[model samples]
Target: MDKIKVLSIFGTRPEAIKMAPVVRAMQQDDRFLPITVVTGQHREMLDQVLKIFKIVPEYDLNVMGKGQTLSTITNKVIIGLDTILENEQPNLVLVHGDTTTTFAAALSAFYHQIAIGHVEAGLRTWNKYSPFPEEMNRQMVDDLTDFYFAPTSQSAENLRKENHASEKITVTGNTAIDALKMTVQDDYQNPELNEIFDKGNKVVLVTMHRRENQGEPMQRVFRAVRKVIDQHEGVEVVFPVHLNPKIQEMAQKELGNDSRIHLIKPLDVIDFHNAIARSYFVMTDSGGVQEEAPALNKPVLVLRDTTERPEGITAGTLKLVGTEPQDVTNAMIELLENQSIYKKMASAKNPYGDGDASLKILDEIAKSIKR
Candidate 1:
């Protein structure tokens, strides 16, 4: 049997984490040749995941820059991929989730009449602008996709609801669960991590860098977290603050100088994954962590009022305790004091996947291009 060439493209940290497992699986399997491409939409953070995965992308668009708009990113990726895809025409183009890169690469491939496999597909909030471009990106990508690797039955249903073809969709679990295998190392070490554990305090891994939670909402959440940590003597917060100036300013002003709260710079994929593994629980406004935390058996208190990932909450692995200070504080308190509720959240089955999502995705790709 001849080897099938697969080009896997992604830009952000979450996309890389989920896609890494699929790429690694392909690299090991003699049946396929994997080509990885990083769009550099999220330069430093994206590179961190690639390094952790030991993946050197065959092409890098390096599209990140100051004041880059959605139009610019979409256009740049389309242009960059035009050349790459023309030269390295693969049997299949695999993209992960909803990102500018995911949509743009799929567009380029479709223009060239190449088949596309969407990993972590069928995720939807339905509201186009709720996630601000991500929702649209995934939807557009799905329209172009010949194969869909839906993470959950719910996600697969979402695709069906949108009138996507049933024959192309595969309900393969999320690949992020598979990524945990490589990232959560036994001998991971960091000075800040040590300082966190040294205080005999339970660490709450915090990450809130979303554009939606930027101004007042973010401040309110930070204030609530500070109050909660202050009230709990044996609790500490380790927040890897995002590089966004607004986030940095707010975090430094509100959470800085607090003994229990440690506001550090943005973490690389390895550091962030290891930190999540060590934490007692997680609080975040990000999408990926909501899915990732369940596998680590950690409770995630979503900072947003709503989430596209309702499956986690439905499965008892997550709680949608929105951005309201009172609600946030109450949720945190319950998790700390109520061991039964905490364990229930932690020990619930991971609805995302049992791993092996990448293999299922590959199988679908093989089926799509076969005959």
Candidate 2:
């Protein structure tokens, strides 16, 4: 049998982090001719993860731009991958989660008449614009998908309801859990965040820069976070603020100049995962973190109104505390003051996976696709 040529394309930091494990698995396996491509949808952050995982992409679109719109990103990825797809003509194209890069790459694969696989497939909030373009991107990627490597049974079920081929959908668990195995370390320390631990402060890891939450919602949440930190002693927040100028300004306006709040530059995968491992809990609107935090047995306070990862909420590992100032304040207080509740959440079994998702995903792919 001929080795299968698998083209794995991703762009954003979240997509890169989740897909890194799968990329590494294919690189080591004999059955795959793994070709990696990046859209540079998140430029610096994307490069950070690639370096951490030691992945050198065979192709880079370098599509990130200042003030780039959804339309621009989609156009760039489709055109950029068009020539690459024509050249490689891989047996299958693999895309991860819901980014403009994911959707466009799948479309380009379909155009090339090549098979397409979606990693972390079948997540849905069903709310068209809540996650901005992400919900729609995931839905459309599945439309072009030949294989669905869903991260959970619920995610697979979501695909079933959407009428995707049942046989093509595989519940392989989330690769984010697999990544945690590689990144999170017992002795991980950075001086930027180490001082918080040295002070014996209970740490809250934060990351929020979603399109919809940029303005008022972000402000409300930031204020609520500051309030909570002010009310409690020996508690601190590690927020790796996003690079967007508006987001940085808003974050500073609300969460600035406080010793308890560490507003630092975005961390690479290793630093971020280790931070999650040592933290008391995570607070974020990031979808990947929703899966990663639970695997570390850390509770997550999802700052979004709805989550596609309902399994976490059901398992008590996540709470969807919306961005209302009072609600965010109350949720933080509850987690801080209620020991029983905290313990339950911290001890809840992570429904995401047990850190073998990358191997499962690769094995299923090899079995399904022939060269």
Candidate 3:
């Protein structure tokens, strides 16, 4: 029996984090040959995740540049994958979540007439521009995808409403949970974090980098966080600031110069997972963190007004505080001051997955290709 050749492509940190488990699973399974490609859309951050996962890609497009637009990323990925697809000709191409890389890779696979499997598919804010390119990217990729690996039943239902074939969609939970299983360690050490722990301060890990929350929204949320920290005596914030210039400026302006708020460089996957594991709770606008934090048994205060991952909210692990200062302050106070509320949110079951999504995804792929 000939081995099924599977090509997995991703460029950004979020996509890389979610897809790593699936790629690693393919590497261990004898039934398939896995080919890895990185578009390098997010360069440094993407490299950080790849190193943490120990994923050495067979190809790197190096597509990142100063002031690159979405159109540029899409075109670069499509053109870069063109020759590779023509040469390797994998049986299927797997893309994760929504990014320019996800859409462009799916587009490239479609151009080559290759089957495409989308991981973390069917997520919808339906508003299209709510999350900027991501919401649209996932929607369009789903149109081109042959297999839809929906993380939750809600996601699968979204696909169904959009007229996607039910049989082609698999609710394999989230691979982010699988990643969390590999990343968080009992003996994980970080000097900065150690200093915070030594002070007996409760840490709140934060990651806010959504296009929608850029200027005013980000500033509002930052102020709310600062207010909460000021009111509480033994609480600290560890924010791994995004590299975007506008964001950097806003973060420094709103949250900087505060001893309690540690504005640090972006973290690698291992450091991030360990940080989450050590934190009291998380507050973020990141989609991956919504799923990952819950699995770590931490309550999450979603900084966005809307979320595609509603499973966490329904499961009581996540609370949508949006970017309103009052709401954000209230949510933070409840988590900090109300022990019962904190326990209820912290102890809620994680709806993402049980950390076997990669195995289930591989099994489904094998079964599909064999048939």
lDDT of 1 by residue, 1-371 (tens): 77889999999888888888888888998888889888999988888888878889988999998998888999999999988888998888889888888999999999999989888788888788767778888889999988888999999999999898999889998888888877788898888787786677789999998777789888889999999988989899999989888789999999999888888888887788888988999999888999889998999999887778989989898888878889989999999999999999999988888888888887877767763
Question: Per-residue lDDT tens digits of candidate 2, residues 1-371?
Answer: 79999999999999999999899999999999999999999999999999989999999999999989989999999999988999999999999999999999999999899999899899999998978899999999999899999888999999999999899999988989889989888778788778776788799999999998989999999999999999898799999999999999999999999988999999888988889988999999999899989889899999999899999999999999989999999889999889999999999999998889889888888888865
lDDT of 3 by residue, 1-371 (tens): 88999999999999899999999999999999999999999999999888878999999999999999999999999999999999999999999999999999999999999999999999988788878889999999999999989999999999999999999999999999999889888888889778876687889999999988999999999999999999998999999999999999999998999999999999889988988888999999999999999999999999987899988999999999999999999999999999999999999999998999999899889988742
**Error at 195, model 3, angstroms:** 0.5
Error of 2 at 300 (Å): 0.8
Candidate 3, superposed: residue stretches over 4 Å from native = none
- Candidate 1 residue pairs that clash: none
Q: Tell me how many clashing residue pairs each candidate has.
A: 0, 0, 0
Q: All models: lDDT?
A: 0.87, 0.92, 0.93
lDDT of 2: 0.92
TM for every model, in the order presented, reads 0.96, 0.98, 0.98
Model 1 off-target regions past 4 Å?
Answer: none
Cα lDDT for residue 343, model 1? 93
**How well does candidate 2 match the true structure in TM-score terms?**
0.98
Q: Backbone clash tally for model 1?
A: 0
